[model samples]
Target: MFNRYEADETYGLHVDNAIRRVTGSSVTVRADLSATLFLSDPEGYDGGELQIEDSFGAQRAGFELPPGVEAVNLKDRPPLPRAVLEPHQSIVFQGMMGEAPRWEDLHWLQRQTELPILVKGIQHPADALRVAEMGLDGVVVSNHGGRGLDCLPSAIEVLPRIRAAVGEDFPLLLDGGIERGTDVYKALALGADAVMVGRPQIWALAVAGALGVAHLLRVLREELEVTMALAGTPTIADITAEALFSGP
Candidate 1:
C-alpha cells in the first residue's frame, strides 16, 4: 500500500491491522513492499514514525533523514540515519516482513531489500548526490509547488546542478511550475527523466472530482503531444537540452 502521513499524525501498528482487514490478509501475507509518503514539516512535531513490518512479523522503524545530509552515501547503508522532515517533505521505503527490531534492524532490512528509493522535494545538487549515495533509484527535483518553503529555488533552476551531481544515466524527475507541455519540455532540457503534476490534478479534483481529473489528464496529454510535434521532437527520448537555450 502507498501510505502518506501528514503533520501531527502517528501511523502506528493499527495500519497493519487496517491493511489486513482491507486486503483480507495480513500485510506480510499480501504485500511484497510498501512505500510511505510524508507530507509535513519534520520540525512541526515529533514522534511520527514510519514502521515497516518484515516477513518474520518483526517491525523495523525508519525515519526521514535530516536535511543537508543528501551528500551522505546510503548505497550500502541507510539513507536516513535519523528521522527528519520539513513541510512538504517526503521519503520512500521498502517494506519487507521480519521481526520488529531497533534502528539497526531496520537498516539491515533496507540493505537487504535493495529496492530503488527515490526522494521527492529536492532542490540542491549536493542533496541529490547524497540521495544517490544512499543508493536511491533517483530523485525528483521539486519545490512542492512553493507550498513548503517560500523563496525556494524553482525545481527547474536546480535541475542542472542536480543532474551534474548525480551524473548522466541517473534517473531524475522534475516537479513545480509544470502546468504546460512547455514546462515539461523545459524540465527535460534541464535534465529530468519525468515530471509530476500536483496542483493541476488537485484543481481538477476540486472542480470535477474523478471525471474532472480524467479530463485534466487528457488535456495535459494532448498539450504534451502538440508541444512535442511543434518542437520537432518525435519521441520523449529525442527531447534534450539542445532543444532549449538560456533566454536573452
Candidate 2:
C-alpha cells in the first residue's frame, strides 16, 4: 500500500463498472471511512483537484434526524441541544464516491513520472493491444477468478493471443489461477514476463507464517526446475510453446 512517487510521478484515476475508487480487477478496500495523510507540503506538488473535501455520513432519502438529534450516536433518539456521540466514536457512512475516471486522466498521471505505468486486468487481447497502442508501459492480465456472469476465460487461456496481439516486447504480468510451479513455467512459455502468486502464499502464511511461505516458494522452484529438466529446457530462456507441445 506504501508507494514512493517522486516529484515527477503522481497517482491516477480509477474506473470500474461500478466507478469504484479501486486500482485493479481486485483491490484491498476498507469499508469504513479512510484518511489520507500528506507528508509533503501542498505547495511542493503540482496543484490540481488533489485535495477534496471528505463529506461523509449516511445518505438515505427522507431520513430525517430525530427532533432532538444534533449528532447521532445511533441509540436513544432523544431531543438534543448537545452532541450525542463522542468525537472518537465509530460511525457508518455511505457518501458519494464521485464519477468514474476518464481515460484522459492517464495523461495527468503520465506528466509526473517517467516510470512505467502498468494497467491491471487487461483480459481481452484487443484491450491489451489497445493499451500498448495508447503508450501504456504494460498490463497485468487476469481472469478475476470469481467467474462472473459472463464466464470469462482464465488469463493463461487468453495469454497467447494477447501476446500475439501486443507482440513479445510489451510487458505482460499474468495473475490468477497460478497454483503450482508448472503453472509458472506454462505462463512463461506462453509469453508472460512473470506471474503473480497471491493465494498460495496466503495459504502458506495461514498455515506456518513466514517460514511456511519460504517452504512454499522452495517447493514451487523445485517443481519448475523438474519440469524444465523433463522438457529438456535447461534454462528459463529456452522454454517455448513448442516445448509444451505434444500431439494435442
Candidate 3:
C-alpha cells in the first residue's frame, strides 16, 4: 500500500504491492488488504481525496467499484467527488482503513513536519521505548481502547512498565477502563501523563448532548480534585508513585 502525507501529495488510482519494506534495510511485509487513515483533520488540508475506481475490484455484490471499473489507467477515469458519499457509508468500501505504521514510517513522518506526532495503540514497554527512541512527541499506552482483541492485559496493568521504559518526562497517555476521577488518579500515579476516557464521554453525550459532556468533564475534574485532597495530595506532581499500591 501507498501513503500520501502532504497536503498536495496524491496517489493516483493504482494497485498495491504484495510486499512492503518495513525497515530501512530489507524487512518486508506481505499485504492482503489495502487501507487508508486520514491522519489530518478534514478541514486541516485540502484536495486529498481517496478515490477508488470500479475497475480495480469489487467492493460488494450490489455496490460494485463503480461503472466501468476496469480502467487501469487513472487518466481513463478521473476521481469522483468523495464528499458526495455519506460519512458512515464509506466504511464498508474501505475495508480495514488504517495500518500499524512502522518505525521507519514514523521516522520519515518526523522529518516531514515540525508538528508533534503521538503514536497510539502501544501496549508493550518495548514498543513504547521504540516510540520514545524515534523522538516522537508522545505516546498512548493503549489496547486500542480494548477494541482490538480478547484476553489482553488492561492498559493500567502495563502503564508503569511503559513509564519506566520512556522515563518520567516523556508524555505518556493511557486509554482503557478509565471511568471515574479515581481511575484517572490511578493512571497518573502509575505514570501516565494523562488518561483518555472514551465510553464515559459517549454515554454522557448520549444522555445529555453537549451540555452533558461538559458537565461530565467538570464532574470528573472535581472528583479528581476531591480524590487528591482526601489523599493528602495538594498538587499534580505530589501524586507520584508513592500514591499507589499493589492490592490482593
Candidate 4:
C-alpha cells in the first residue's frame, strides 16, 4: 500500500497483518515480506520516517513526518485515557528519524535481506545504474502504474534505456499498461526479464473473486504462449529487442 503522510500525520508502530471483511467473511493474511519505497525527496519532507525493528530488538529509522505529532490509542481498555501530550510536543523513541540514508542505508538493507531485493518504480537509466552500483539484486522499470504521477512516461518507454544501463546480466522487470498477453510479450522483447499485471487481476477479482483471477491468469498464459509461437519465438529466452519496433 502506498501511504502518503501529510504534515503531522503519523502511523503508530504496528505489525502489518490486516483484517478485511469480504462478503460477510473476515480474512487475514500475514505478509512474508514487506517493502517500503520513499517517493518524496528526503529534503522535501520531515518526520515521516520508515522505522523498523530487527529480530534482535535493534532499531533503525528512515523517512518521517513533521514534528509536534503525538500518537494516541483511543481504544485502550480500563479507564478512559486523558490527553497526556499536547499537539506541539514531539516524542522521541529509541529509534528517531533525525538521520536519513545515503549510502549506509542501502548497505544495511542488503545485509539484512536473505531474499533478493529488487527496487521498483525506477524510470531513469542513472537510477538503474545506481541500483547496480549499490549491489541490489534487480530493478523494476515502472511509472508506478501511472497511479502516483500521471505525467510520467510509461514503463515500456524507459525499459530499454534502463536495461542498457544495467547491462544484460542484470534482472529487470516491468510494470504498467499490461492489458494483454501481447503486451507481456512486448515487454519481454523490449528487455523486461518479467512483467507484472496489476489492474487486470483486480478487475478479475472484482468480477469473480479467486476463480476470476485464476481464469484470467490461465487465459493470459495461454495467450502469451500463442503469441510466442506465432512470433517464431519458441521460448522466453528467444524473445529479443528485434521483436519490438516504434510506430508513428
Candidate 5:
C-alpha cells in the first residue's frame, strides 16, 4: 500500500483501519505480507514515516529516510534528479509469513519468517540489475506515475532494458500510463510480468466504492482477454515481443 501523507495524521488513521479490515485474524485468510513504498523524502515534508505492526501486535519497524544529501547514495547510474531520503528514512518490512517454509519466507522471513521485499521507483537498468543481484524477487519499473519527475521515460520504454539487466526469468512489474487492454498487452510484450493500475482504480472507487472498483477490474480483465484473443494469444504466456510494434 502507498501512503502519501504523514503517518501521525488522518492518513495514518485511515491506513490503520484498512489494515485491520484486511489482516485482522478474525477476517480469515490473513495477509502473509505487507509493505509501504515512500513517494517523498522525509525532509521534503514532515511526519510521513512508515510504521508497521507485526502479527503479534508489536510495532516491528518504524522507519524514516535520512534527509537531504545524506540520502543520496552513489547508485549504479550517473547522477540524476531524484528525491533523496534520510538514513533509516525508507520503511520496508514484511507483515506476516504463514507456517511452514516458502519463497515468501526466504527474503523477509529470516528476521521473523516474513515474505520477500523489494523497493521500486527505479529507472536505470543498472540500478535494477543491482537490486536483483541482492536477491530481491524483482523490481517494478515506474516513475511514481509521472508524479515524481517530468520528462522521464515511460515505464514501457525502459522495461526491456531492465529485463535484460535482471535476466530472462526475473519478474518485472510496470506502472504508469496504462489506460487500456492494448496498454496491458504492450507492457506484457515488452517484458513486464504484471502492471499496476492506480488513478483509474481510484476514479472507479470514487464513483462507486467497492462495487465500482470491482466493475472496473472486470472491465479491464475482459478487455485484456479480448485483446489477447485478437492478437492470436491464447494465454498470458503466449504473449511475446512479436505481438507488439512501436507506435506510429
Candidate 6:
C-alpha cells in the first residue's frame, strides 16, 4: 500500500451512463506491457479518469528503462539486447503520459477524483507544504532513487526539514536508500510515517526468486528487532529520536 508504485485496475473510475455516449470512443494508450487510462474523449463525455502509478518527480517528460524493453525473452531467454545508445543517452518512452507531472496537473486531477492521491519525488519542505495546500493525501519523499538528477540530495537527508514543514499530522513517507532495517528505524525516527524500498526486492528476485524475497524480508525483520532491542524500544511506537544514536 505504501510502495513508490501503485496501480488501480489500470482502469479505476467510470463515466455515468447518462453522459456516456457509445459514439464517444475512449482514446486509449496501449503501452507494450502496461495500459494507462486517460480521459480520452473528455469533450464527448462528462466524467473520465487517469492514473500514474509512480506519480511524480522528473526533470523531463515521460519515463523509461535503460533498454532491453523491446527485447523478447522466450522459453530459452535471450541475452539482453545490446545497448543501442550510449550509456547516458536516454531513450524516450512514447506511450507514457507525456510530460513530467506538473503543479497544474495535480490541481486538475483534484477536480477529477475523490480518491486519495499522493505525489512522489518530493524532497523539499516547501513542496511538501504545497502538497498539503493542494489537498493531496500525502507525499513520498524521494529523489526518484537519485537516478534522475545528480544534484538532488538523498531522501533521508532532507526528511527532517520536510517533517518540520508539514507538521506531525501530515502523512509523510520516505523512499530511497532503504537497504536495512536500521534504515527503516532511523527513517521513522526522522519523522516518516513509513518507508518504501526498491532495489533490494529486485536483487532478491534476481538471486533466488520469491523464496529469496521472503528470506530478505525475514532478515530485515530480524535486524529491526535487534535494533529495537538494543535501543530498548519494545514497539514501533517507542522508536523515537531517543532510539536514534545520531540526531536526524
Candidate 5 deviant stretches above 4 angstroms = 1-113
The TM-scores of all predictions, comma-separated, are 0.54, 0.58, 0.60, 0.58, 0.55, 0.59
lDDT of model 3, residue 66: 55
Best-fitting candidate, measured by lDDT?
3
Tell me how far candidate 2 lies from the true structure as C-alpha RMSD in angstroms: 21.5
Tell me which of candidates 2 and 4 scores higher on lDDT.
4
lDDT of 2: 0.74
lDDT of 4 by residue, 84-116 (tens): 222233222211233334557778888888889
The superposed Cα distance between candidate 6 and the true structure at residue 115, in angstroms, equals 2.7
User: What are the per-model numbers of colliding residue pairs?
Assistant: 21, 5, 3, 8, 11, 0
Ranking by TM-score: 3, 6, 4, 2, 5, 1
Tens digits of per-residue lDDT for model 2, 113-173: 8999988877888989888988989988987674543588888988999999999899999
The 10-residue segment of model 2 with minimum total lDDT is 89-98
Which of the numbered candidates is closest to the native, going by highest TM-score? Answer: 3
Report every candidate's CA lDDT.
0.70, 0.74, 0.76, 0.74, 0.70, 0.74
Write model 5 residue lDDT over 20-44, tens digit each, in one string.
3333333322122344556556556
lDDT of 6 by residue, 14-46 (tens): 422111112344422212223333455534544
lDDT of 5: 0.70
Clashing pairs in 4: 46-65, 47-64, 47-65, 48-63, 48-64, 48-65, 49-63, 49-64
- Candidate 2 is scored at a TM of 0.58
Those runs of model 3 whose alpha carbons end farther than 4 Å from true positions after fitting are 1-100
Give lDDT for model 1. Answer: 0.70
